[model samples]
Target: MSADNEIVELKSHNSNFILNIFTDDYKKAIDNIKQKFERGSLLKDISVINSINAKDLNIIDIQRIKDFLKTELNIDYKEKKIIKKNTKEPKKEILKENIPKVVKADILEDDNYKTKIIKSPLRSGASVSYDGNILVIGDVNAGAELIASGSIIVLGVLRGFANAGAKGDKKAMVIANKIVATQLRIAEFIAIPPKDDKKSYSGVQMALIKEKGIEIQQVN
Candidate 1:
């Protein structure tokens, strides 16, 4: 940006754009990245079509970088690549049948659902969102959150807030071995207990949203 010649209309026609910045500008870009990350600006809309120069583009998470732009400056940009298919040859149609269908809310029950296992502690500021049952083999600590489109299970502990059925899945539940949550939510339901309800030994507790209210029970 120090260059007296400011950005003008690009010279390449029908070609993808390159920031075309100086290599030293990387430091400034990194500073900007750190600032946005600390702010927890969630970039909702942005995508990565492809990569150009690997050396230049591989330095950062391009998707999150786009998100940072949108979050910090309200800018959404997609760097697209033009792919020209061979028109002369016969078009080979490949069916995509192996991809699993993404599950959403309104399951009516958390039973018969497959639980996703995460073998790590939920660190502060770290968030996880899933479409099926979420089972963490670690603690859900304070200032951390676990949100599931389906049910959630903690193999170790659940101390922070856990939100089940973030996308209107009213039947989603929260199951934890050690319960010490700051708050809890299921579907449109929410609960904030008066004290840190620490469970003795290993116990199984389930949470549900009944009539838009969070309810808990010792199931096992």
Candidate 2:
């Protein structure tokens, strides 16, 4: 935990973590996370991802560095945001109970399941249930909620409520990179994300099970 610190990701079922403060010297990343909160190594949920430039450091200097990491590490301050990455994206993996190489090479490739990784940004009350497969690297904001019995990915921007398979497994699916979620489900089918007036929407969206039911496309 040096070379200017970098524990890129961790979400032990919401015990949360995602350091990575690649030096732009916000006081040398808050004194290298205050020497890893004096060697107790900042546990009990952490979040210090920074790319700076919030009008040159704002939000009361990021709440005074989350109040000095909760008074020098008694740890617990569940939220903070300031992200910006793209060195060609791709490189942020953390599915502890393993199973994600694009969900085992494309949707559980003959099912072996086991994936649950939610790093942050599931704002508005936050909720996440799982039985298998559920990966949200961030943003499910607008009233956050996600239940999964299998299949439910959101690499970002999926404005709320998601209920993939949820114990039914009707070929569960609900991918997203921006699906202004009004509501969504998979097993006992339910969805809504198409009220187009050509609002200039683009690719990378999906919602499975289709036989005149839940169907949303564009995965290219």
Candidate 3:
């Protein structure tokens, strides 16, 4: 412990700390952390350890925590794990939304890939980056982002930013039920939604690199 009430050093060399939040006074805890950081007594890379009492925290609370850590403390927001005292297995809580599903498939003898599925609305200011393909079953609200090395499939509306083929795979594409995003990137090409606000379009659309430019066309 660094004399801070809620922060305790996990090790000397590591800057990470076990942020112990015992009470539901989340605002108080954040203020304490901010004060400690301003005084140069606290550092980044925090593993928020909360008591079972704090388990009832909703998505708003979780987002607030993340935002405070980033804007106030300048933390990169590494990892957040909760360990309820006396629990057999430490519950893996997914702060804003539920945990994503990972699926592995063997498409060919040398082709094995993974897919991550998100089943909740991706809120503004939230970002989801995956190494493999990404499937979102909910809306990608404005100010949110999704970046994937492989193809990105949004079963719901994609109103935010999306970057596919992040690793230079030009064949990768972004598919969405409805796309009204301000920006979309595929491989090295970037594009914005039509400025004319043309309302004529099909139910589904796909974005990909066409002739070295990002193109969005109705999906047949």
82-178, model 1: which lDDT tens digit per residue?
A: 4466445432222232211112222222243445667788988877766556767778888887777567877666888787765445667776665
List TM-scores for all candidates, in order.
0.47, 0.24, 0.48
What TM-score does structure 3 among the candidates reach?
A: 0.48
Per-residue CA lDDT of model 3 for 1-220, tens digit only, reads 2355453223332434444444455686577667766665444444332211234343234445555665665653333233345524322323343222211121111132356778888989988887767778788998998887677878778889887765446677787767888688775467897542646555567787788588887854
User: How would you encode candidate 2's per-residue C-alpha lDDT over 1-220 as one tens digit per residue?
Assistant: 3453462222243433544444344565677667665565544344433222223333334344545555666543433333455445343433464333544466644233567777777888787887777888777887888877678888767888887765446677888766778688775456777543435445457788878588877665
Off by over 4 Å in 3: 1-112, 195-202
* Model 3 score (lDDT): 0.60
Q: Please report, as a residue range, the 10-residue window in candidate 3 with the lowest summed lDDT.
A: 101-110
Off by over 4 Å in 1: 1-114, 197-202
On TM-score, the stronger of 1 and 2 is: 1
C-alpha RMSD of each candidate structure in angstroms? 13.1, 16.6, 11.6
Name the weakest run of 10 consecutive residues (lDDT summed) in model 1: 97-106
Give all candidates' CA lDDT scores: 0.54, 0.61, 0.60
lDDT accuracy of residue 138 in candidate 3: 83
| lDDT-best of 2 and 3 | 2
